[model samples]
Target: MSPVPDHGEESYIGSDRLKGRKALITGGDSGIGRAAAIAYAREGADVVISYLPEEQSDADQVLEYIKKSGVKGLEFGRPP
Candidate 1:
C-alpha cells in the first residue's frame, strides 16, 4: 500500500450543493457508494446506505464518518 487510496474522505469540498437533500446509496459499505455516503453527509444531507448483513462492519464505519458531520445516517441490512 505504497500510496494509500483516496475515497474523497479528505479531498471533497462540499458546499451545500446537496444541502437539505437525502441520499440512499447501495453497496455503500465500500467502493464508490462509500465515497458518496461520506460526501453527501458532509454536504449537509441525510445519508442512508444499504448493505448485506455481512457487510455491517464496513457500513458502520461509513456511518460513523457521516455522523461526524452532524447529519442523519441510517443503514438497511438485508440478509443474503
Candidate 2:
C-alpha cells in the first residue's frame, strides 16, 4: 500500500496571490497532485480535483484542506 503522505498539511501559507482564480487538477488525490491542489487553494483559487474512484479517501483529505482555505472545493471521480 502506498502510504498517504502529507502534502504540506502544516507548512504552506498563502497571501491571496491567486484570489478569484479557478483551477482544475487531474490525479489530485495524492502525491504531487495533492500538493498542487493544496497550494492552489491556499493561494486563493477555488479548486476542482479529478481522480479515480478508488482514490476517494485521499481525495477527501485534499478537499478538507482546500475548504479550510475558505474557497470552494470540488471533486470528480470516475466509476470503477
Candidate 3:
C-alpha cells in the first residue's frame, strides 16, 4: 500500500512493522507526540494518545492521520 501525504512527507501504510501492536503516547497531541503517532501508525500499531484538554484539535488531527493508516487511534485526556 502507498503512504499518504502528511506534513510534506509521505507515509507508507503497508510498510508498518508494528501491525497489531498497541502503544500509549503521553503527549500524543502535538510536537514529538504527534510525530511518533504518525510513525507508529505507519508501522501498523494501534495508538493510545493522552493530551491536555486544550489540545483536542491537535489530538484529533493526529488520530485522523492514524486512522488513515488503517490503525486504531485512541485519544484521552490529562486529568486536572
Candidate 4:
C-alpha cells in the first residue's frame, strides 16, 4: 500500500470546529476510524480510541498523532 489512504497525517487542515469536545472512536487502530480520531484531535477535541490488543501498534501511532495535535487521547484494548 502507498499509504495513500489518508489518515490525514499531514494534508488535513483543522479550524477548531470541534473545539472543546470529546469523541469516542471504535476501530481506531486503523482505517477510517484512525483518520477520524486524528481529525477529531486536530479539531481540538479529546479523543478515546478502542481496539483489539493485536492492533495496539497501530493504535499507538494514532495516539502519537493525536497528542501531536495538542489534544488528550485515551485508548482501550480488548482481547480478540
Model 2 per-residue lDDT tens digits across residues 1-39? 468566887899989999999999998898899999999
Q: Rank the candidates by lDDT, best first.
A: 2, 4, 1, 3
Q: What is the TM-score of each candidate against the true structure?
A: 0.85, 0.89, 0.79, 0.91
Backbone clash count for every predicted candidate, in the order shown: 0, 0, 2, 0
What overall lDDT, based on C-alpha atoms, would model 2 receive against the true structure?
Answer: 0.92
Instruction: Report lDDT (Cα) of residue 59, candidate 3.
Output: 85
* Candidate 3 lDDT by residue in tens digits, 1-80: 25642541254344778977999988988777788888888888999999999888878888888888888988888445
Instruction: Please give, for residues 1-80, the per-residue lDDT of candidate 4 as tens digits.
Output: 78568889998978899999999999998999999999999999999999999888899999999999999999989563
RMSD, candidate 3, Å: 5.8
Given candidate 1, what's the lDDT at residue 20? 88
Report every candidate's CA lDDT.
0.87, 0.92, 0.80, 0.92
* Model number with the top TM-score: 4
What range of 10 consecutive residues in model 2 has the weakest lDDT sum? 1-10
lDDT score for candidate 3 against the true structure: 0.80
Candidate 1 stretches greater than 4 Å from native: 1-3, 78-80
Q: In order, what is each prediction's RMSD in angstroms? A: 2.2, 2.4, 5.8, 2.0
